[model samples]
Target: MIRLSMMMGRTAAWVACLVLGLGAAVQAGTVDVYSNNVGGDAVVGASPTVAIGSSGWYYSDVRVGGTAGIDSTFARSGNGSVLFQGDASAGSYKADVSYSTGESLGKLSDLSSFSYDWYRSAASTNNGIQAPSLRLLLGVDGVYKGALVFEPYYSLTTPGDVATDTWVHSNIFDPNMYLWSNKDLPFQEQFNHDIAFWKSEIGNYDILGVSSGIGSGWYGTSIAAVDNIHFGFGEGPGTTYNFEVGAVPEPASVVSFLIAGGFGLAGAAYRRRRAR
Candidate 1:
């Protein structure tokens, strides 16, 4: 009887360890970053000038005069950095670029959620004002054919005053508010719209696009810096099973364990009755 109880305890402990190990595997997540450079311009699907800063960070320069019409662009820095700075124009100076990872990973689907810390220099009257805007775009085959635009909640018009780099988190799931109220649909809807638009415009091709430009304008008036751009599929932190992992255990294993435990307890009870 003592040996049987010890065996049962060991079995239970082993089962618990296995369950914990499997749980950890399922909860794993991954992050990747792409730095915009001149040589690898094709990687991002658009050709933009590359600028190497003194800090050793490669920046994509899309000046308003360039073929791609970007003043300057930098997605990820050399150290896997997430800081970005650029200028935009209301009329002519616009930086349109896209980053793609191709496919989704289960429920994490594509980057359905995005959060970034950003701030803009006050808009300048002489060198154009920087009323910075934020936009999220989706890419397919390296092209940004469309986007879902987010309006500028904070505008900086004062010179030398820095806009606070507050972390802003947004989920592109509210279609009614995003599309109807803001005159723009959610990210998924925007993607669908671009697909139909592309079918009509380019015929039989998948639509690759973005969420929208945060600060859009002409004349290099809109200057802004952004950092910590995080993209993920499910909800951002603090929710049950928000980022759950792996498959459930086999039903047979669970049933077998239950039956075995019950039998062991019954045997122990019978022994006690016989002794009494």
Candidate 2:
């Protein structure tokens, strides 16, 4: 009788701990790219260093890194906006965001989808269009493998259009919205490009770049104002969440399940002993 009593007590305590932990440790998560509060003192692509959100980062390309900043005059949803100004000379600049898991670095493959909002006013002096782009880069242990490229709708054609100043939402994973640079076109391709690298054995990173001279046409001033960004994990109508720059996921969920299992086994043993 005492042994069963002790077991029941132990199980009750374990269940209590789990319930408390879940309430205390569970966090609302979201990967926010930029907002009204987030801005920088320097212009993106032209400046060597720029602010991503609250924690700022550096930017540099093969040619040179430019400036990136937040714009107060224009904003879609928030009071402020993030702006990237193109450099006079030709070059591409990229700013890498820091995201990781408990054991491994977070890669593009970790998330099912990512999206952002932006407005662009650009013109191409050269034959090709040098525009700002977002990418999911894949590499093996460190060596570069490939990237999933996303180009804005207005930037694809030769003659650049003046942005209506209204904000637009773009989901990079959606086949209709984004295009792959090295891979074959979406759906119709004999092979899937982005998926291949994303599922590869190596780790990958995410990069946001504002290019000057490059692809289809070279735009001297690809003046762009961007805001409201999100990276989704198993994201959909009900499963998505949002997190800031510094926040990280905790292991409370796993612990909760384990504790619940222990309680179940203890209760079963108590019932069987009582019957006997």
Q: Residues 38-128, candidate 1, lDDT per residue (tens digit)?
A: 2322212133533322222222334342222122233222322232233332244433333333442212133344444444444433143
The Cα RMSD of model 2 versus the native structure comes to 11.8
| Residue 31 lDDT, candidate 2, scale 0-100 | 24
lDDT (C-alpha, whole model) for all candidates: 0.36, 0.45
Score candidate 1 by lDDT. Answer: 0.36
Q: lDDT per residue, candidate 2, 143-216, as tens digits? A: 44445565564333344543444666666655544335443212332223344344353324433222211222
Q: 45, model 1: CA deviation in Å?
A: 16
Q: Return the lDDT, model 2, position 64.
A: 42
Worst 10 residues of 2 by lDDT: 237-246
Instruction: Supply every candidate's count of residue pairs whose N, Cα or C atoms clash at under 3 angstroms.
Output: 26, 22
Top candidate on lDDT is 2
**What are the runs in model 1 whose C-alpha is more than 4 Å off?**
1-61, 65-91, 102-112, 123-132, 136-145, 154-216, 235-276
